[model samples]
Target: MPLLRPRDGSAGDAQIPATSAAEVAEHTCAAEAVFHSGVWSGLDPRERAAALLRLADLMERDADHLAALECADAGKPLRECVENDVPGAIESVRWFAEAVDKLTGQSFPAGPGVLALTEREPYGVVAAILPWNYPLAMAAWKIAPALAVGNSLVLKPADTTPRSVLHVEKLALEAGIPTGVLRVLPGTGAEAGEALARDPRIGALSFTGSTRTGRRILTAAAETNLKRVSLEMGGKSPQIIFADALVYGEDLISQTIESAFLTAGQNCTAGSRILVHTDIAEEFTRRFVAAASALVLGDPEDLDTDIGPVIGGGAATRMLAAVEEARAAGARVLLGGTEVPVVEGGHYVAPTVLDRVPAEARILREELFGPIVTIQTFTDEAEAIALANDTPYGLAASVWSAQIDRAIRVSRAVRAGVVSVNSYSEGDLTSPFGGWGESGFGGVEKSLRAFEQWTREKAIWVSLHG
Candidate 1:
């Protein structure tokens, strides 16, 4: 078992259980038993919804404690965990709890004396493999919908941050969800995640992580049970700014900074690529660098810190190396290109801004997963759209233009799942968040669409006998 260390590299008291492949099998079998037993899945939809609502209430009551656990495990800023992540998790639960009962199948016109109808049924057992970036919130995103729709879940928390999710299991149980309906296994992806993927008992698998890992999970699904697989993968998302949009000035710069550096830039939807119109590129870059440089970086527990450490030292190393690589390839480091030594072994990469990075540079092409943004210039609308759509990823993007027509046109032109005009947003709980290209596959998370991931629809037909 590996001790889970926070981003600061301090001694962490928590350690994830070393659940082996065989143990994973045992857990899956238990989940299968629970699914077939009809204790959870057989409940009335409203009953299940009520239990989920209770669970959400419990989470809200313990929000501060949950936030602390997540902060210690993920090295996220404490304020962010409390103000954003925990609340977001609670909202996901409440949203799904309210929705599962409202989820309805369709009725169709068949014939003069015939009837056709469809009803949705829960998948037998679901497995959700989570990423380390947003532990509590991501877990809730998958767990809430899957459980609310009446499925037994086998959750494999990320190896590096498993405590908060482990705590969630207790809360779920306390909230009247039956034993074995929700099981949390804390282990490495190789042993636990691979087991869940390969388990024939799993009716579906939902994963949020790297594109490479998503591919392997897809392969495992195909080779074994042919289970439904939903993947939300990597991205190199872009933020485009037209000269006219600069009129918003400081407000625009602030939003753009948050887009690039939130979660220390570990977000899959991070706007790491800045495609600014050449007409205002110089001014925008200057203001952007200044704002980014002024962002406060310190201990995750600090209330005033704007940026916390990256996940670990390895991430810090990679971020610094990418900055150097971009510099070597004719890019200028307009701001930070160094590490910030906060705590003794803290992994803090200073906020970095790379200007004029060549299109071919790795920093522009790969997902850095750190506090770094690359700037590039485009002259016309066509070129801007071309630059935004050039990446292999189509996860999320932002289009900024003072003209509503221009913003709408460019927003439609961008090849991403979610696009925001004049701001950065993934939309509220109503939006279906998923990517188009290598960024996602099979299905999406959030909104009513997510229910499809945990359910199977069956059509029924009846003919009147004369």
Candidate 2:
């Protein structure tokens, strides 16, 4: 079959025009230098803010076109693109636009006879590598703040979803971002991604993707220029439900199924592990299976569709292999275990739920990264906490209980970075979002700490004159 190509002459493969590794490296390095030496990093806070606002406006105006391109590239629901992805991306730009002027450096009290102050300076050129899932939103997280702080960026979108990056670049250009300040290089990670990572001209790197790839990038950063690297990687997040939880009956069943199955469970923050009290495990599993079994799987463009295909063929095969391995290891397949019908000829997997998963199973230890959740039971709170933290991942988790104290206690006890009480994976622009352990390091935009990652604090001291 012929590969699908966008009107811009870019596709999953064959996107980059560079014919050699040296050419790719040279182009990426030149773009990074241009951005660092140009107006992007030199603009005043207000000017940078205005540029961001214009970018947001352009994103809003082109929401439909970009969303369609995103859906085509990612196989996600088109409605999700318009309702969630595009709006979220635009809001990120707007938030950072307004936040630039408000973001200020700190001054410390100097000892007698000396004056001291600290100022945040942009980290020169930044390389932002975005994943396929939620491409625009991830890009916005890196782009908005990096630009707002007056740093130029070089972006590389995932191999399967480069069109959205091009679309975003075009929007930024339309929004008056000066040329060479923001450039999109669409190619394989081995080529364009590594080139950007190893380039000495790029001062910092922000990545959102799998842990294996993140580790590789980190190694590259260390071996090459030792640049500042911020990574948001994989997760096998847990959603614990206590006996006294408010979501006991119908709500528990519904929320658990939806949270795990959203985006076909491709979300890094998806509630893949359901920890239920021993007394309620069977009941929870039954309801969860029923709800998940009923989800409508079809064309992503269909407004009524509840689920869509996995991002690509390799992902779908991996998900299916996990399911088969779990079943082979004596786990019960309570819901789906195969693909469903789709309008487009692409990869799709049904929402699946595996019950009685053992600790030793690969599905339990590793991120399934698909619409598959494993249910486990514990007799006590300590056991529940132990079960939740068993995996190497510590990205996000949730605790459900009617008693606020129980929820609070469990929320604090969980090893993940972001934990919710009585809810699942609700992140906003005002809050910080990142991971712990193997999930990766450094939070992205919205968090006050995120700004620090993009900047280097320079302390200035002056001796008092006699």
Best by TM-score: 1
Model 1 CA lDDT for position 211: 91
Report the C-alpha lDDT of model 1 over 95-160, residue by residue, as the tens digit: 999998788999898878988999998888999999999999999999999999889999988888
lDDT of 2 at 31: 70
Q: What are the runs in model 1 whose C-alpha is more than 4 Å off?
A: 1-11
> lDDT tens string, model 2, 1-466?
2132422221234333422346556666667666657567777788888988998998888899888888777778787888888898899889878877777767778888888888898877787888988888888888888888877788888767777778888888888888877877776677778877788877789999999989889899999889999889999999998877744667677777767987778889999999988887777777788888888887777877778788767778888898899899899998888876665566778888888766689999888789988899988889999999998999999898899888889889999889987777556877888889999886564655667778888999989888
* Candidate 2: C-alpha lDDT: 0.81
The Cα error of candidate 2 at residue 458, in Å, is 0.8
Summed backbone clashes in each candidate are: 0, 0
The deviation in Å at residue 242 for candidate 1 is 0.8
Question: Model 1: C-alpha RMSD to truth?
Answer: 1.3
Off by over 4 Å in 2: 1-20, 36-38, 246-250
- Best candidate per lDDT, number? 1
lDDT, each prediction: 0.90, 0.81
* C-alpha TM-score for every candidate: 0.98, 0.94
